[model samples]
Target: MNAPRTPLLEMRGIDKAFGGVPALRQSRLCVGRGEVHALIGQNGAGKSTLIKILTGAYARDAGTIVFDGKGVDFKVPIAAQRAGLSTIYQELNLVPQRSVAENIFLGREPTRFGLIDWRHVEVESARILAGFGMSVDVSRPLRSCNTATQQMTAIARAVSMRAKLVIMDEPTSSLDETEVSTLFGVIRKLKADGVSVVFVSHRLDELYAVCDRITVMRDGQTVAEREMAGFPKLDLVAAMLGKELSVLQGTRRAGPDASMPEVLGVQHLRSGTRVKDASVTVRRGEIVGLGGLLGSGRTELARAVFGADAVDAGQIRIKGKLVKLDEPADAIARGVAFLSEDRKTEGIIADLSIRENLCLVLSPRLARLGIVDNRKQHEITEEFIRKLGIRCAGPDQPIRELSGGNQQKVLLARWLAAGIDLLLLDEPTRGIDVGAKAEILELIRGLADSQGLSVLIIASELEELVAASDRVAVLRDGHTVAELTGDDINESAVMAAMANGTANAAAPAQAGIQEVAHG
Candidate 1:
């Protein structure tokens, strides 16, 4: 047999720093031709730094990078793109108002005599999408399509650049099972065409399913590299977390319990295709999970309950009294707070200081005669910063200055400081580091136990839902198909529910017991 193909791109001894703080130290990655290489790490593991270095968003302090047999240094993102490298970020960078064809061939659309060639753009986009087994209308605005379609469009755009190496950051985070499998097919196609892919995701299952090799990073250093064939999932987790598998698996030191009073109850809730006929009970002193595939209506259920969306038909009761929630303020006034999924869009006012962002929701309580109490705001902000371990330069620091994880913590603090009785968290720990995830989980648990607070958490990571939830309610096709509790709330059970809407009857009863805990 011929020798194995050489790596299409290689980076050795890459080092990087942010604001004088070392973020990545000597991390190494090699992406072979026609292979999927995964990068795994906890939050703050320097994953972002490494990607930035590769994409030319940030210059590496020290490294030897060779792409397609040529040693090179990229000083800007454009240079990397021109060199056949394309990155699809976790945040889904696309102009929603633009058509699919426009987004795919944005800057370099077909032109005739200095004027744009719209007809050619659509034909090219259609042909490209057809290769991926998609026939979506390329002329329609991107936002009109479901999130999965939008993601597919992004992938198509990347490949249209003739990218030899595609960096997919959390590509499947927002995709359903079917959509995810479809994406995998596309990845395989890319590989068959001799394209190298860098896959980064918090979901280990996806990594195991697609990656040929795994590179583990921790605290800004490449810790281990292992082939996928014999790699144990637990070992992968251990590597990313910097802990042994045995040490990581166990009951939480303290977790939520059953038999809690229902702080908020919804019977037969419906909101768009995202949420349909969903019923859930969040009890005081417990963290219940809304588990499902992407578009299973987990976030939609949260939004409906929090009044972010109109409940087409349902009964919502708080403290045993039926209530009307016409808007966010109505929910807030009823002691229910929702932390939205996208923090930058819905959670933070970037121009505001950390203190202001924390107090934005609670300002009414601190206000006297319509005059804001700056002194009280400062005190509360200081208290939360210390309590939540939010890293910031000071209270005066703009909220935008913090990292993604830190910005998320501030959003959590915003709701926690309000001392709401019921919290609807949509992917509360999303995009955060492992340590931050654990910390946030612990904080939510403690708040439930100590303050009799109730929480309904929606997270895409199934392991997180399994670990943090006292009970789990799974949705499928916008309906609550299964509920698990106690012994039934495991990865298998949640997966089954999401896949086929099947569950052991004992699961719901176990969850019923926990509901009494808070009552």
Candidate 2:
């Protein structure tokens, strides 16, 4: 019998820090040849830090990296790439001004007689892209392509490198259902070709779908490592969050207060093809969830209510008064704040400091005679940072530098600072870790109970929807199919309603009720 084969990559006792603050301690990982391994943790839990150390983007203060059975310490990203390691970050590193072909073969274009070969670049780039089932013009600027195309282009570039190990950070964040399926196929092909992958994503379903082994990290330490098959989802979440299942449930309200009045009401709402007809009501001090499948108009309905998107035909009532919310400003003036799902593009002003981003909407109010009071701005930022337990250097720190969890807290704090009465949250805890999700959900429940903040939220995770929502309105095919309240607000009931597109006829009337939705 042959001797046991060694892992393709191994890191042991890795330690790293920033500004004297430890980000990783005793973090270790082992990846076998041709294995798809998962690295999961909460934001700021050392996932990114460990990956950076592996890719040579950051130097580890202490540890050993053994790749292909040899110890090595690469000084820079290029050096690591040359050593058969490639990383495709969540943030695209390609140049917007360059064409797809130029990006794919950047720094390594084929040569013909000591000169550049544009023809080879185009043909080879197309061949690589075709492997991902993408058929866009290779000559076009990468910026002109859709988000899915751009992501596929990035993956093509990584595959073309022909590295031994590839690290993908949230690679499916931009892709749709079909595109995600295509990506899975590509990943399978890569496995067949004997390339190992370090897959990182917050989405749990995707993890179970692709990864063979799981490594859970929490608070800069490796907590658990197990085969993905035997590991339960609850156990994985518990390890990543460092909490028990009971404690992880967080604070869920005992349904809405009976005395509380409806703060937000939409009747027969219509917005483009995505939202044909939708109706729901959220009472003060209540969290209402929009439950639906992909492309079921949950996001569109939320946007229309917040006035971020156009309302083709609908009636909106705020506090029992009909209002026309034509624009976001109109909604804001009426005490509505929306947390966008696309955090990078629509939620945060990445270039600004945390102080500026937090107080952006409230700045005008702080201004006296066109001069905003700087002291008041800092005061608000400090207050919310403290209130939300935001871990940061200071309010002046660039918001882009914070982890996903802290950034999300800042966005929620932004609305809290603006004195908004109603909150519309789209995928509030999408990319953050399980611990962050717990914190955010608990915070929302606290707001609804203490501040009487009415909330209408969209969540892709059925467990999250069932746990956080006081009442869940199920929608399918752009129509309000059923509503689940109190005892009926469970995963099975929500999934049934969404799939069947109708209320349960046998149960009590309160068990399932369809909203007043019309086409």
TM-score per candidate: 0.64, 0.65
C-alpha lDDT of residue 384 in model 2: 97
Error of 1 at 397 (Å): 14
RMSD (Cα, Å) of model 1: 8.5
Distance from true location, Cα of 16 in model 1, Å: 1.3
Clashes of 1: 16
lDDT of 2 by residue, 311-358 (tens): 889899998899988889999998999999888788889999999999
Best candidate, lDDT-wise?
2
Segments of candidate 1 deviating more than 4 angstroms: 1-5, 90-130, 133-160, 173-181, 203-205, 248-260, 265-282, 285-317, 320-326, 337-419, 423-519
Q: Write the per-residue lDDT of candidate 1 for residues 204-245, one digit (tens) a residue.
A: 456667778878888899988878657654455446545442
